[model samples]
Target: MTVNSISFPHPVLGNGDDISDGSISPEISFQISDESIRVDVTSLQTGHPDFDRMIEAGEAVWHLRVQCPRTYMREDFFESGSNKTFHLEGVDFEGLVTIEVSLVTTTTLATYRPQGLHEDYGEEKFRLGRGEVVGIGPRYQFLIDKIYDPLKAPVSSIIRIEEGEDSEGPFTVALDTDLIMIHLSKSDYKEYAGITDRVPTVIHSALVLPVLADAIRQIEDYAESTLWAARLKYLLDIRDIDTEKPLQAAQEILFSPIARTFREVNMRLDKGDD
Candidate 1:
């Protein structure tokens, strides 16, 4: 039996003996916040009795795949579910995110992807019968350059930070608000994921400090010198960090000069110390 027709992903063929072309259009919902993203899949009707009963009765389980900028995370399956939600916690993902929600017979969760369902990769692939792909809300990117996509750029660089091997949840980065956010480069992501020689490599912040300074210099040249009459204030969202170190560093770098200059001008005005 030649199986044909598929609404999304693509049209394909299955086994000759199987002959059963089952499709489940489960309801997928999503909500995003500063901390984590929550996804719930309901309306679990697949026209298969055992499958339907298993889902409604909480026998069917689920796992989640959350795709991020430069990387992706594969999470464990929900313990049991009828209309349960799987939370992608401690996840620092912005922009368009694709999540594959799967319902499986066994407790083990399989890593699902669109290409895996292809005929060539079938046997070793994570079958699609148990899963559906849903996208997050529209992703807005603040490209640094006035025009041109970063993915199309000849070269690209990025700084990434995340929790260690034993941790869970999104990795938080404190920014000064003035810095522009570049969207994730899909080209770099693909290479990085492939573990190829030309793939993106994780580098230390210090390594990119020069590139950052140079970029800033270009902006300063374009905008001319930025002068402010009032004191410069830094608003930081204090998370899990040693505040004293950063505070001290800032004081030494900027405040020290201001303090010294103010004292010199004040002494000159007084003429003599009382």
Candidate 2:
């Protein structure tokens, strides 16, 4: 079977408000209400453990941002408010088609709002608060650029796939589950790809493979533990597979190490580390 669309399911970053991901909610757009642009999210009480606890606390702040395809950051913070509606009218939303979501903790919410301050975040001299950006799913160079450690985090910067459809919900990895490589059939690919018009043969081209492979290699170069080295090897093997099943193979390779680290390293969940 031919590979179609690809998805990057973001791993949960934190225990509470420190996590924010695009898969929680679909692409939310601004509704023109009189002189204001009204942004609304429909996904509620998703039962995702990471977000559910924070939503229960009533101290979480949601941030919305959109970026252009060509330019990594051709968008800005439009508005911010409670977990519901965001109103803004300053920047142009024309080229900024990709929407990203950030769920900041109570500590971050009180310190900084996501609007007007978008520019400040870029050049802020002092340190800023911590949180997670579940916004925008993973894209090319995503793992190479950064691989999140569920252990430590002040904030998370997620990937937005340019090739995937905005309506195709974010790839979800269960809090209790670890990403594993599955020899996906066309049916599985369809499930991941969702309903898209174009059939992409491969997500990681020849040029992209080496870069990703190199990144995974670097992780092993410095990994002190034998288990870590073995885990990293799985990742490297997946990268070189060069089959139509790149996404599936990579996820398993990516997730196996995570499962090992979390299960073996520490009782993060039991101790409430987020």
Candidate 3:
């Protein structure tokens, strides 16, 4: 999420307050190259005397969090200075990466009041619990470029789900030059693809899993040359899935949907949802 989306409990430095006004000034910069992302915090100054006092007393500390949700990667750094690098050797970061800096309370603070606590807050002091953010910097974003356009990539991309004719079977596979199309019978498509679109796992478990499993088996023989298979193989190779075991690889890549189904059901049951 962006910096503006975050709701801070109190006035934080660097939002709009100037450095000369005794606010925080974190001079942060970053670079990405050759399978590594480096972030530098050249200067971290808590200009306000109250914030400075907390830092000196070890009640607060700096936290730098980096996230690459596309690659399922998140790392947190507690260093108060420069030179932080995150290695991304085997991770495939196909989209956005974000970095956030926050000053968090290390210990619970009673009746804490910063130097310039605004009267508009309706209180001069606040009881801040441990781990609460005392100050926050801008949330930075960087886009990672991809060789293939995401909208045309296979499976959910070029290989897509379609509604089949009334006379067609419940699930049908059509392998084309640029697509691996899975057609669900008209009624089933309406139910799963249309009405239940928000929860895609239902469709993936029932339809995509079998189709992907079959595609994996045919990769070396019938489907290898197809664009769908090429993309599928790339996905498996990047995640280090063993294609020799087709069913296992498909399940692994799809995040073991059968198990996920049971877990979801149990969660709903626990919540007493109908």
Rank ordering of all candidates by lDDT, starting from the highest: 3, 1, 2
Q: Write the per-residue lDDT of candidate 2 for residues 242-267, one digit (tens) a residue.
A: 32454444344434433444463355
Candidate 3 residue runs with Cα over 4 Å from true position: 14-20, 81-92, 146-274
Instruction: Give the lDDT of residue 121 in candidate 1.
Output: 47
Q: Could you tell me the TM-score of candidate 1?
A: 0.31
lDDT tens digits, residue span 1-274, model 1: 0122324442221222121333444566766565766677675444545444555655455444445432344344453444657776634543334444444544222443323243544555343443342211121111112222333421222223222332333223222222322222444434334442321222212222333333333332322111110001111111122224543433332224345545655675697632
- Candidate 1 Cα outliers beyond 4 Å, as residue runs: 1-22, 53-60, 107-274
Candidate 3 or 2, higher lDDT: 3
Report clash pairs, candidate 2. Answer: 20-134, 21-134, 101-135, 136-159, 137-159, 180-252, 181-252
Model 1 residue 226 lDDT score: 17
TM-score for each of the candidates: 0.31, 0.27, 0.47
Query: Which candidate model has the greater TM-score, 2 or 3?
Result: 3
Per-residue lDDT for 21-115 in model 3, tens only?
A: 47444665556554655566656656777776777778888888777655677778775433344455434553456678778888998887665
List runs of model 2 lying over 4 Å from the truth.
1-23, 27-38, 68-83, 87-91, 108-129, 132-274
Candidate with the greatest TM-score versus the true structure:
3
Q: After superposition, how far is residue 180 of candidate 1 from its true place, in Å?
A: 15
